[model samples]
Target chain A: MSSYNWAPGFIDDGDRAQIVTSRFQYEDGHTLDRYLATGGYAGLKAALARTPTQVHEEVKAATLLGRGGAGFPAGTKWGLCPEGKWPRYLVVNGDESEPGTYKDRLLMERDPHQLIEGCLITCYAVGLSQCFLYVRGEMALAQERVAAALNEAYAAGYIGRNILGSKFSVDIVLHWGAGAYVVGEETALIESLEGNRGMPRLKPPFFPAAIGLYGKPTIVNNVETLANLPWLLTHSAAEYMAIGTPTSPGTRMIAVSGHVRRPGVFEIINGTTTFRDLLYGDEFCQGIRDDNELKAFVPGGGSAPWFLPDQLDLPFEAKLVGAAGSMLGSGAVMVMDETTDIPVAALTLARFYAHESCGKCVPCREGATWLERIMERLVDGHGTENDLDQLLEIGQTICPGPFPHAASERLGLAAVPFPFKMTTICFVGPSAYTPVHSAVTLFRSEFEARIVKRKLIPVSIGASDE
Target chain B: MTRLNDANQVLAREIIGRYPKARSATIPLLHVAQQQNGYITQEAIAHIAELVGATSAEVLGTCTFYEMFKMHPVGKYLINICTTMSCALMGAEQLVTHAEQRLGIKAGGTTPDGLFTLERVECQAACTEAPCLQANYRYRYRVNAAQLDQFLDDLAEGQLDAEIPAHGVVARVRQSIPVDRAVSVVAPDDVHEAPVWMPLSGTTA
Candidate 1:
C-alpha cells in the first residue's frame, strides 16, 4: 500500500481469488470514482434493499470470523448487542500495531471506500447509527486517505442521513490512536475511544456489546472484518462459504515477513493453505531467502509461539493452529532462517511486550518487564542455567499451569493445547511469555550456550548486503 | 508553550463537536495540541482540558498513557528505528547501531544540533519491508546503512523538506463533518426506543 517495491504473488496472478485486495493494483485505487467504477458500494446498495434483519441473517449464515487476531465470528458478536438498546455504535479497530501484521493498514490505505462501505452495511444490519473508525496514529497515509474517503462518501450520500432514500441513517467518525498495541483489544479500544488509558476492562460486566463507548451498546470490529462485508453481501452466504475450508471460509491476507526470498502480504486460502505453501510454494514466498533452511517461524503475529519445520504442512486454520499450541493471531507469519539466534529473537519480542505492557495488570507490567530483563541478560551472555529456569518460572506467574509450548513434548512438560491459562487481565500478559516459552523450550541448547559463554555473543542473524 | 491559537481552537472545537460526549475528543485534541506545539505543553494540556471539560490532570493522564504524545520536546526530526523481532531478524539492530554512531546519540537521545532524534521502537506494522524506520511517523522501508546515511544527509540539507514534516505533524488534512451532514448527535440517555428492525421486549424474533 506504501508502494513498497516488494511484489506479492497474488498481485500479479489472475488465478488467485482476492476479495479485499482486488483493486490494490490499480492507480487511484483509494478514490471513490475508482471504487464506484469497480463495483465498490454495490454491497451497501444491496444491503439497503434488504431488511436490516435479513442482512444480519445473510452475514450470520456466512460465518465471517474477525480477522484482527481472535477468530470470533463477526455475526455472533453483532447479535450480542442488546435487543432494545438505542443509539448503538459500531467501532472499527484499525489499530494494527502487531509486529508481523500490516494487512489492515493496507486495507485502510489502499481501499478505504471498501471499508467505509462495509461500515455502512454493518451499521445498517446491526441497527447502529454511529460508527467510529479507530486507526493507529503512526499510519499517516491511512488516516489521511480514510478521512478524505469519508468526506467523499458524505458528499456522495453513501454515508450520513438517509442513504440513497433508505430510512437508515449513519454517521461514521474517524478516530486515530496515539501509539499503543494493547488498545487493539476490544474493551481497551472502547476505553481509548472514551478518552481513557487503553486498558482492558474485566469482561462479563464490561463487554462492549453491553457497556461500550460512552456506556452504550457498541460493536467493535476490525478493519478487515468489516471489509469482508462488502464482498459477502454482494454474493450469497453459501457462495462466500464455498471458497475456503468449511470452518475457516474466505481468503485471509497474511503478511509474511522475516527471512523469505519474496516477503510481502499475500491473500491465501483460509484453512486449506499450509505454512509449507506460504513459505515454499512458487505462488507464495518462493522459498526461504538465500537458500537457507528454515529454522522456526511465528505462525501468527508476534504473540504466537514458534513453530518448527515439522509443522509446516499444517493448515492455516484457527482450531488446527490452536490445537498445535499456538493460535494464528492477526495473520502475521514471521519466518526465521537457520542463521537466526533464537534467544535474541525471543528477547526482541519480549522487549516489545515489555514496552507495550500498559501496566494495567501487575503480571503483564512487572512480569513482562522482568522477562525482558532476564532475556536481555541471557542474550548478553551474563546468564546461567538458573536464569533459564527463572524465565519459565516468571512465565508461569503470567500463565499458570504446566504451560504447553512448542517444545513441551521434548522438555517432558505436558503438551496441553492452547487457550493457555492466564493469570492476568488480557492476553498481553501471556503474549510476553509466548516467545520466552517457545524459544527456551524449543531451542534450550541455544539459550544454554549463551549462558555458558559468559561473554557478549556476536549476533550474526542476517546479512544486509543480501 | 502557548494555548491553542485562534485557528487551532476553531479546529479543536470542530473535533469536539463530532463526538456525542466532549470527553471522547481528548485524544484528537491532544494531537492538535501536539501539532501546534512541537510536543504537548502544560499550557496546551490546560487549554485542551478547558475545551473538553476535563481537568488538566485528567488530560495529562490520557496523554501520558500513549507513547506518541511526548511529554518533553523532541528534535525537529524524530527517527524511530524499529528493532523488534521481525525488523531485528532483518538487521534492524545493525541499522540502529549505524544510526547511533552516525548521529552520535543513542536510541532515546536527540542530536546536539537538535536536527535528529533516534529511538529504538516496537513494530510499525511494515514488517514485510524488514528493518523499516519512521522519520516523524512517515515510513522508510528496507533501509540499509547507506540509505540511512543518504536519508540523514537529505534531511540535513532540507532536500526532503517538502516530503516530510516536523515531529508532531501527522497529517495536513483535518477531518470536518458539517452539522447538517451529521446523522444524529442525540445523547444516549435521550434515546429510548430501538430501531424498527430490532424486536421489542416480549416480542418474538
Candidate 2:
C-alpha cells in the first residue's frame, strides 16, 4: 500500500525529530523494542542520572506550556507542587474529548512509550509515587494499547519500587472514563477518579496543586505536554526553545478535519504557519475538498469561536489567534466551505453544549437549553425578528458579557442578567454561549433569513375581531 | 441480576489492586459489571460497590453521570450514528432518517426483536470519515444506506459475533495483569456490602 500523506503525526515538511509521534514511521512502533531503537527512553535514563530539580530546571528553560486547551506553563505548574509531600500524584490528561480534536488519541495509540516516558519524567520531577492516565471511554483502541504498554513497562522494571536502580519509583494506574466531556477538566477528572460525577470544581482553593486527587497535591499535565519531556530532556533545552515562538515554544499537533482534501493530523511549529497554508499547502491538506470556496472555519475545536476566510492569515499561536477573536484551543481546525449553513452549524454546537451541561450551575443549565431552542427554531424556519436577538441575549446571560453585547442591548432594552461575567463555577457555562455568539455576529443574515414574517397575536376577549 | 463470573471477578480484583485507594477503581469495575450484565442492575451495582469500597448510592452517582454506561437493558447491538457537524455536513441526518425507517424505530429506540438499539449521538472523533456510526461503539465509517442494510442483515444472521460482541461486553482482550508486577492487589480490610441506595446529604465535593 502506498504511504498515505493523510496519516496521524505525519508532518509534511519538517525535521524528523519526531518528539510526540516518533513511532509513526515504523511498524508496531508502540512496542518497547521499536520505541527504544528510536532513542525514546534515553531521556528518562538521563533524568534518572540527575536530581529531580535539574529535570525541572531543563523543562523550565524550555518554557514548555500545557498542550491542553488552557496554555499554562507546565514547568511552573510542576514547580507549584509543594515539596516533600507524600503520595503526591501526577495525572496525565489523555481524555481527548474536544470535538474535532484527536491528536492525543494518536499519541496514545501509536507511541504509548512516549507518553509513558513523559509520565516517568514528570513523576520524578514532582516527587509523585503514582501517575494516573485517564483515557476517554470511547477510545477502546487507545485504552487497550496504553494498558498493554503499561504492562510492558511494569514487566521491564521501569515502574514499581526502585525504578531503573534509581531512588525514584513511580507506579502508574490507567483509568478509563465513561463518556463525559467535563472529565477533561483537571478537577472534574479528579472527582471522576474518586468515583463521583465529573463536575468541575470551583477555583481559589480548589486548584489541583493545592487540593487535587485524594485530597493531596497533584500535578495534572496534558498528554502532549508530558510527551514533550522525553524530547526536551534528550535534546538541549535551547534546541527545544528554538523550535517555536518564545511565547509558545515547540511544535504542536494540529488535527485538520472537515472539508479538507486530506483530513488528518500534522505537527507544525507554533506561530510559523497560517490557517491558509495549513488548508491549502500541497504537503498539508492539499486544499479544500471538492474545490469548494471557504466560507468560515473553526480555528480550534467546536467549542472555540469561528473565523472567516479573511482571518486565515492569522498565525497558528494561541495568544495571536485569541487576539484575532478566536482561539487555537486543541489545535483542531474545522474548515467549512461556502455550501455550509451557519445557522445549522451553530445549532449543532448549541445542542452539544446543552446535552453536555452538568446541570449543576444555573446560567449554564438554563441558558444552554434556551440557546439550543432558539437556534433550533431559527434553523427550522419558525424564528421571528426578536428570536435572533433573543439568542444573543440568552447567550450573553449564559456566558456573561464583556464583549459583543447582544443586539437587544444595542437597541437600549434592559439587558437580561446585566453585568454578568464568568458567573458559573466553571468554564462550561461560557463555552455554551461562545459558538452561538460567534455565529450570530459573523453570519447574521443566515439567522435572519430563517425567520418568518411576524403575525399579530389575538387576545382571548377580542378573538372575533380578526 | 446476573453477577460477574469467577474469571471476571478475578479480573476485577486485579484492576482494583492497581489503584492506591480501592474506591478509585469504581469505573473500571463498573465496566466489568456492565460487561457481565448487558446493563448495570441492582445486583451488579451492589457487587461493584463491594469491589470498589464505596456505597451503592455513590456507585450510582458515578454511573449515572457518564453516557456510555447503560442504566437499563438495551438491545444486543447498540447502533450509534454520529449526527455532529462533520457527519451532518456529509448528510448524516439523512442516514439517521434512513436507519430509523429501516429499523421501524426512532433515534433512541430499540427494535422489537431486541437486536438493535438506534441512537443519534454526537461526534465519535471519526470526523474525517464522515457519516460514520458505531455498531456497539465499533466504528463503521463513510456508511451509506446500502452498507447500513448489509450491516443489519449481518446482525440479523448473527454473523458478526466474533468482531462485535453483544452489548455490554467491553473489550475482546481480557484484562489480565501479571501477578508479580501488579501493585497492591489486596482488598481493603474495611470493605463491606452496600446497605442501601441512599444518597447522602451534604459535601458532594
Candidate 3:
C-alpha cells in the first residue's frame, strides 16, 4: 500500500487520534478503550481542573480555525460566546452533508471517540454543561458509532456528573438532523435539533454563540474544528500555532473528489500545502485523467467559485480565494477534466441547488430554478447570443456582489433585497449563479455555437448541429 | 419473534417523547414499526400514523421525503447502493450490477426469497471508501462487484458479525448483520449498555 508523507509541521508523535489518517484506525468496539488509553479525556480532565477562562485562552492562543468550510477562527468565535448564561450549550455540527465533503463522515464513523474528546474539551472551555452533536440524519452508522462512544464515555465517568472527579459536569447528546444541505449552517442545525425545519436564521442578536438553542447561549463548532480541540488542549496555543500560517492555524481536512486517481480525504497543515500538491500527489490524483486538458475546478465544494487551470497553484485560503472572486465555502475540491461538458455540469449543479432551495427567499427559490432552465436550454443547443449575456446578467442579479448577501436575506423573506439594495438576495441565490456564470465565461464559443442565427445551435462540437 | 413487548413500547414512547408535536414523530414511529415488522407495510404506516396522531398523508409524505423511511416492504436485509456523484465516479453502477446479479433483483426491488432488497440512494457521505453501500445502515465501504457477492453470501450464511474494532484500525472491514436487525434483540454481549447515557431529568442536552 502506498503512503503519502506527512506534510511539514504535522504532529507526528501524539496519540493516534491527533494524526489525520491514523485517527480512525481503531474499530467501533475498541474505539472507546483505545481512546481512553491514549489520553483522550486528558484535556477534559485538565480543563476541569482549570477555569473556563483558562481553557478559552488556551484555545484562543492555539488559533484554530473552523474546518467546516467557513474557516472562521474557532477560538475567537468561542470567545465571543456570551457569559453569565448558565447551562450554555455546545453544539458540534456533525452534519457533514456537503455533496463532495466526506472527511467528517470518516472521522465520525471511524474514530468517534476523538470527536467526543474534542467535544468534551470544548464544552469545558465554553462553560457548557451540555453539548449536542447534530449529526446528519443520513449518517446512521456514524450516529450509531457516536452513540456507542458516548455510552462508553458516560460509563467511564468521562461524561455526565462530576466528570473525571471534577465538579464540572458535562453531558454529550448525539442528535441527528434530517438530511438537508442548509442544516449544515449553525442556526439551521439548531432548528433541526429543536425538531423544526432546517432553515438558516437571520443573524445579529440571534448569533448562536449568544442566543441559540432554546434561547440559551450556545457555541456551535464544526466536527473537524472540535476534533482539534483535544490537540490544542494538550499542546500549548503557541505550539499549535507554530504549524500553520499566522492567520490560519492547525491542519485542515480536505476532501478531494471527482476525476482523481486516489480520491479520499487528506489532512494538510493550513498554508503549508497548495492546490497543486493536493491534486497531483505523485501516486494519488495522477494528474488529470486521459491526459485531457484541465477545465475548471470548484475549489471549495459546490458553493465556491470555479477556478481555471492556471489558478490551481493558488493557496487554499478563504481570503486568497475571495481575492480570486471565489469563496472557499468548503474545502471540498472537485476537479473536472477536459472532455466533460462544462455547461451540462453547471446545469446539473444548478438544478440541485434549485431543487434544494428552501424557497424562503425569492432570489434563491426563483433565481436557482431560472438559472437551471437557462443552462438546460444552453446545453441543449438552444442558447442564443443574448442568452449568454442574459445568464451573466441573471447571475449578477442573484449573487450580484463578490460576497453572498447579508444573513438577513438568507433567512428573511425573498422580497427583501440585498443589504445594499443591490440585486441578489442571498448567497445561495448568488452561489447558484457561480457555475452558470463560469460556464458561460469559459465556454462562450461552445455556447455561441449552439445559437444559430435565429434557431437553437446544433448539438455538435464548436457549434450545435441542430 | 420478540413481539411488541414493554421494552419495545417504552422505546417507541421514548422516541415519540423526543418530538414536541405528535405529527413530527412520524419518522421515529416508522423506525419503531420497521423494527417490529422488519419492513414497513401500509398497515404499519397506518398504525404509526394512528399512534402519532397524524394523517395517513402526513405520515406518507414524511416517509417519502427521507430516504431512510422505507415506504414499501423490503427483504430481510436491505442493501442501499449510493448512486450519488462520489459513489457514481467510484463505480457504484458496477456495485449495483453485482448486487442485482447476486440477489436476482434489480435496484429498488427485493429478491423472490425475501432475503434482500437492493436500492440506490444519494450520497451516504462515505465517499472516502468509494462505491460504498449501506447494508441496513451499517456502511460497507470500498465495495466492488466481487465484494458485494461475498457480502451477500456472508449475510445469507449468517456469518456476519458486527464487531466494532479497537482504535488505530486499518483494513477494509465489513459488518454482516444490519444495525436495525439487532435493534429488536438486545444481544447478551452488546458492547453498549443502555440507560448509562440516558438523562435522568427533563433537562435537554
TM-score of chain A of each: 0.94, 0.92, 0.86
Model 1 chain A worst lDDT run, 10 consecutive residues: A1-10
**Deviating ranges (above 4 Å) for candidate 2:** A1-17, A404-420, A457-466, B174-179, B182-205
Candidate 1 Cα outliers beyond 4 Å, as residue runs: A1-14, A407-415, A453-466, B196-205
In model 1, which residue pairs have backbone atoms overlapping below 3 Å?
none
Rank ordering of all candidates by TM-score, starting from the highest? 1, 2, 3
Error of 3 at A184 (Å): 1.3
Candidate 2 lDDT by residue in tens digits, B1-205: 4777798798888777777687888888888888888888888888888888788899998899999898888999999998877778778899999999999999989999999999988877777677788888777877999999999999889898877888886555533455665444323222222111111220000
Separate DockQ for every predicted complex? 0.60, 0.25, 0.15
Off by over 4 Å in 3: A1-22, A25-30, A204-206, A283-286, A290-292, A377-390, A401-427, A448-466, B1-5, B13-30, B37-65, B71-120, B128-135, B138-205
TM-score, structure 3 vs. true: 0.76
Candidate 1, residues A1-466, lDDT tens digits: the string is 3243422222334267778888888757899999999998999989988877788889889989999888888888888887666778899999998889988888887899999999999888888878999999988888988999999989888888878877778889999899999999999999898898899998666468888888888998999989989999899899889989889999899989999998878888899999998889887788999999999999999999888886788898988877777889999999999999899999999999999999988989999999999999899988887898999999989988866555344455544478878888888999999999999888889988887644667777777655
Pairwise DockQ winner, candidates 1 and 3: 1
A275 in model 2: Cα distance from truth in Å? 0.7
Provide the RMSD of all predictions against the true structure, rounded to 1 decimal: 6.5, 6.6, 9.5
lDDT of 3 by residue, A17-70 (tens): 234445443343227767767667666667666666678778877777788876
Order the candidates by lDDT, highest first — what do you get? Answer: 1, 2, 3
Name the TM-score of candidate 1. 0.95
Model 1 gets an lDDT of: 0.87
- Residue A435 miss distance in model 1 (angstroms): 0.3
Quote model 2's TM-score: 0.91
